[model samples]
Target: MSAELRDRFFALSTGGAPADEVARYLAEVDAVDTEPAATLDGLGISWHPTVRFKAVRFVDAERIDADVRELFARPSQEAPYLAAVFVDPRELSFRTFENIVPLDRLLADTPLDLDLTRRAELAEGAYSFSLRLPAAARGHLERLDALNLYVPPLNSGSRGGERFIFHSAQLAEALTKAVAKALPQPLRDGFSHVNPVFRCNRFEPGDANFHRHRDTPYYDAERHHVSRYTLLLYLTGGSATPALDLTGGVALAEIEPFTCVIFDQRYEHEGAPYDDGRKVFLRTELIFTFTESEVTHDPEIGALFGKACYWTGESVFAPELARHADAYYNQVAAAHWSALTPGADREPFVHKQFRGVHFVANGYDFWFAKSDKLSLAECAAITLLDYFNCKLGDTSFRALCQSEVIEADEADAAAWIPGFLQDKRGDSAVPPIDKSLLFPEPEEANNECCPFHSWAAFDATRSEDVIELYTQAQTFAKAHILPAPIVMLGEDVLLDPDKFVIRGNSIHVLGKESLTPVNFAACWNAGGLPGNYIDIAATVDTAHFLVPPIFFTESDDCYHLRFDFFRNSWMVKHQQVTIPVPMVQDGVCDDGDPYPWRYAVDEVSLFTDNASDRGKADLWWVDNPAVEDEMRDVFD
Candidate 1:
């Protein structure tokens, strides 16, 4: 009610007034009280008369949850915070919201302790009170305005939440002490003083006022550190409605000069908008974290650490790695620059642009049994190949042709595969494959079938000797080089054998429904070593697969398999004949850009101009689509 209207009511009821007039005044007062409070334009009072008494009434219930009752009984206990109430139950009260600190008192040089005590009294008595900020803190904000030291809101582009922000050590210390006094001793002990920031949020016409927000939970994975509590203090603002409202509970509309609100950080609340009016307020947060050393010692947490870091002790020394990584990143960034192509859209396959060697060591599995000398190079080749296939979908090898080189060294390799991968500086000097080789013209010749196909010369039924499947497969592969699907029937039907056998087998190709006998030379098993080590076959399915090759020489390890692309090792060997891995697109043949060789071939020419550097004749292939038909004819 306005003061003018209240004065008229009192005047009429006082001294010698008619009984009817006094009764009318009382009736009007009752009516106004029962009706909703009047609000100014663009401003409102959110009141929930029931919220303040909720805690008390809940506790008073006979059938209240035991855990909730216990939590209300002692809210300051450490760990396992109660979920029913976000704030400390002790701070909640059922009382009228009023400003304990007036603007005049805040302008005065009042001691912070006296103000803090006054604020606490209001809290204990009325349940909600807005006390004045410490005189020194208020003066500090004035000094900031005078010196023009405030910076624009850091997150202005998003929610222009702050007008300006300035840091003050003196203000932080005083506020921290004031907040510490409110919290119970148990909570105070766990609190670590983080540097506080003083920010003035402005609510003006068309400005984005504060929205509902919660502080981010501070987490430290290594130490298992996490935030426990928070404190927020509201200093000053212009609008009458620009006050803190713990929605459904308390609203400190008429705040005194240094009015502060302290609550648990997890509380869901928002700053009331000033509407068309302008308002400025200072806010500081006191963040606390719990450092429970026991988390590190717990068996499950310890196991997680081992699993997360891949059992490498290197994770323990982060500072050492950070120092080197930072310097190295800077050096690499300085050496490379990207060309800007305006209006050009990025390729779908372009993961991202990097200045230099961008390394990402995601999750990895490093459990492998060591055999023989335990060749590190072989491990690198195997790991990279596995990563290429599993993570990048095997097409990454083709995608690498356009991507910036990412140099990965042993130090940068994932912790799981430590000391296994190292940067081979000379590998960069090797030329990349020519693009023309990938997109050969129609005149290019495809791989021809072996002229003297001699696999039929061998009589399998007559031979009862046991021999290595790998050796026999290699012989058959070299002899019968056809694009059609070739099947080598081993001693067992499924190809699972610990020892070799002379069992008769059968072979079949697509369209030929009946299985042909193995003695008819219908089978060719040159597909390295199958997992079963039994019936090995390399069918013309057009699907690319990588199999562990049995190396004859120690020198033919991972490095040779990966980087020594000049040689035709069994791991990256291209087949002699070509076949269409039929891909039906809209029920028609979709040859898929006719360059499986870009992925299948080990070496690619990096020469931009086709005529400048003719590649080795032996290494090049003329991809002919007609060969697929010829192979199909042979199969049929």
Candidate 2:
């Protein structure tokens, strides 16, 4: 404590303003103690201290601690946890957090969960690494100015200096408190109450870019301590550069205030450099290990949690959803919309060769059954398309679909895959998608007004702007040719109907179900010919041709269910069904995982118009003899 004001603060403490008040003040001072003092030395801890805007030495710890507490106690309009002492730079670097983490104990305690295995191989793998955020938490992480730290030598001829400030205390405190509360148990003890490893970093605007590498808990070359899951909390500043370019991984943008980019360390990754001036990103990373044994799972273990597989209603809030519902709607409208709304352009749908053309949208399985075997890539693709379709409507939506994406598939893969695989093309971080799987058959869209750029249009199509989607779809399936379909036991779906679309490219189905009042599908075949159909399927997504047979059943959770492909919105259609999740929960796995699911879809046949005497059911069978043989081979 400085002698000049040491006596003043000391005088206040001894003045006896109020007995209770004195006690509270002292307790507040005590709360921040020992930790900061220890940070100075004794354990190779790297830290800087300040008292009343002045950098102070350890001898003045009491005064420094008291001042910081005083600042913290003041109420702010924003979240309190956000209020913090920001070092000039923003980085979560603290010595205790790094050296003392119980790596071995944590690893031994946690288990590799097999919940997803039970859910289905694909769904299980995607959900294993995916995490969700509560609405408030997500909001807090997306908003601004927060505290950070800074330290560096002075410019030439200037005196060396060190300082810190409250970048945005309100925002910082909110983040700190939210994180403290949201952390899983193992993490709570390591952070909020008492932390063993406290490595914090102050991310300033001038930090060097990161090499594509896994984060390591210990500075060993092996980097084995890279935790299975980690959260990079952004407190302040702007950062970009080594934009996270992990292959097949969720592409993460630079440090944004309030946002915490959670990720798996096993993936190959990089953080863009801090090139923006003066921005500070107070960053913190929390990693924990868990195996199958630590947490146990039981059907109805705790209070029976409610889950909805299909959002039966609408509200301002985001509902849970499947990955393909919205994309499916766009694919349908791309080929069939003109039939309902004359002159609608649909070149965008066929050209992109969306990853999953024929897969059932989530609403179908969500309301009718429960299946999580969807891929993250498919989910993200649907999400982007869903957003455009909702905000832009048919014209702009079509425009965007044809407009060349500014970035490449791999460029944005971080959000979809673990980083271990991001491979870039040339100097750009995004790599072009191979066009092999995405193409149309020979005939293409027959709409006379639609632009016919060219057949085998490679260069322009490679960019895959909205217009090119039409070209790609044509390459996949024209009137003259169609790709073979995948056949499995007990089920057969028409890969490419000989007559898909009647006028432009479209497939016509019988039954009022396809031509509901909403007209999501073109089922009213003006020309009553069983062989006439629209060629609307995208090669990348052959399943695009058929909507799942909608059925309302118990969504595991036993909630009321509903699904409509046109109601495409992120998380809007998702409903959790808490059925009997038969996961590999207890015997030898990480039990912390939520229950997984397994599902079956079969007996698919198209409805056809036939008088009662001619057929038992008015329908046409997709006679792929190969389908029956395949099914027998698979499940036999």
Report the number of the highest-TM-score candidate. 1
Residues 1-636, candidate 2: write the lDDT tens digits: 222233333344334587776565445443432223221111211132222121221111221233244332211224333222212111111111111111122123222221101111111111112223445544433332321222221110111122222232333333345555554454354342211232234334554544344443211112212133344444444645544455456554554444445444444455554566433333334433334453233322110111111211110112222112222232332222122222222111111212222211222221111124322222222322322221111111222222111122422322322221122101211112323333333232232221134323322212223233334223312211222111011111112222222222221311111110010111112221211122222212121212212223322322122223322211222110001101111111223211111110111112221222232322122132332333334334
Q: What is the lDDT of residue 393 in candidate 1?
A: 18
**Candidate 2 local Cα displacement, residue 92, angstroms:** 19
> Candidate 1 lDDT, tens digit per residue, 1-636?
433333543355234888887676556544542211211110111111121111111112112233333323211112112111211111211111111111222223434442354444223212323544546655644443332222232223334444444444545566567556655465576566544445555554456646544443344443344444434444444444545555444555655444555654444345754553545566545555545553222222222221222112121112232223322222222221222112212110111111111122221222222333333332333333222221111112212222221223333233322223222111211112221221212222223222123233432222212122223333322223222222112210111111111122211111112111111111112221111122222222121222222221112212211121111111122211211111111111123322222122111111112323443442122222232223234345
What overall lDDT, based on C-alpha atoms, would model 2 receive against the true structure? 0.26
Question: TM per model?
Answer: 0.30, 0.22
In candidate 2, stretches whose alpha carbon ends up further than 4 angstroms from where it belongs are: 1-206, 218-226, 236-242, 247-257, 274-636
TM-score, candidate 1, is 0.30
lDDT of each: 0.30, 0.26
